[model samples]
Target: MKPKPPTHITVFAKADGAAPTYWECPSCGFLSGDARFLDTEHPCPECGAVGVERRRFPSDRVRRLDERIRSYQKQGDGEIVVILVMTLLETILEDILDRMMDAHGGDLPLRRMIMDSQRSIGVRIGKLFPALAGEEFEEAAAELGYRDFPKHWRTMREARNAFIHDSPFGGPRERLDARMGEDAMVLLDQAYRLFVLLNNRFVADGHTRS
Candidate 1:
């Protein structure tokens, strides 16, 4: 069957030279990273303004971000599944960290949680291969340039910030749902790709013939 046309969410992009930051909410004065949830009556959380309209436009660096956003609006089962799977993984990881912190009588900050995962995996690898040691892989990733890891992290964080701050995007629940779902999928997919890139590097480093 022919696919349905994608609904274009109104994305407001910053100037071209700047990073794709801050989506303006259409409903209210709220400006945030994600505008998927704002509608007219809801008003802007930031300024209590009403009857605003949201329009989103991403930069070239964030062009791919719109692909899945459009896909979700088109209601593609495959894209939905991909997004759900990645969200599940994130939830599981968070649970594991929570349990570990409970056992240790401490909490893991967001940055620490990400760093610990890499370090834990690296430790296991080091034990099996005496040549590689602590922090070496991280250093290599920093030096040789691992793609998407940090970029996706930033993107996801930005989206979350936009959602929380009640950017002007606040609006009717139905419209917001469509926007939120799209933004969530895009942000998660970006993270998933980064994780995959890191995993691929891990596999390649460990699979040496020597």
Candidate 2:
């Protein structure tokens, strides 16, 4: 069966200050910050579609938080680094899901209500994300060269929970050390690229949003 087209598309406009500019391909949903993409005629790296219209990606808040996390990591604040990196990763996941919803013609209130009903990260990733993206999250991650991302993310989450909750029966299983913090930083870097790939595969197709 044929799919419907996207009802609306997101476009990028010029912004002030040090914030980066982003562009999204109208044809394939490939997004990039390169100035060359803003030109009238450019081939999409993913789909090879010509003269694709590129829209701006609205990610100012996410960018700011990412910068803050990087700054803290440099100071040897392992605890903060681990916690913040997890938060950032989750935030990116949320953003991607939101875009996916938007691609499906889901309104803001509906998206909020649906998301609010499923607050657990495990449910969101294991069930909700796959249902929306039309494939399992782990499969997508693996295809995108992030085969270990899910496991590593889960491990970090366990460490963060252990540190925060300090289980009554077992006590804290382990301390979030510098090594974990370093791992978090690496994941943080990878998350953006992976999310973008996911977006292109699932959300960037113009049919999804329609």
Report backbone clashes per prediction.
Answer: 25, 8
Cα error, residue 97 of model 2, in Å, equals: 0.8
Give the 10-residue window scoring lowest on summed lDDT in candidate 2: 1-10
Please give the range of 10 consecutive residues that has the lowest summed lDDT in model 1: 1-10
User: Could you give candidate 1's per-residue lDDT for residues 77-111 as a string of tens digits?
Assistant: 43343344334435423333333233233435743
How does model 1 score by TM-score? 0.26
| TM-score for each of the candidates | 0.26, 0.79
TM-score of 2: 0.79
lDDT of 1: 0.38
**Candidate 2 local lDDT, residue 161:** 86
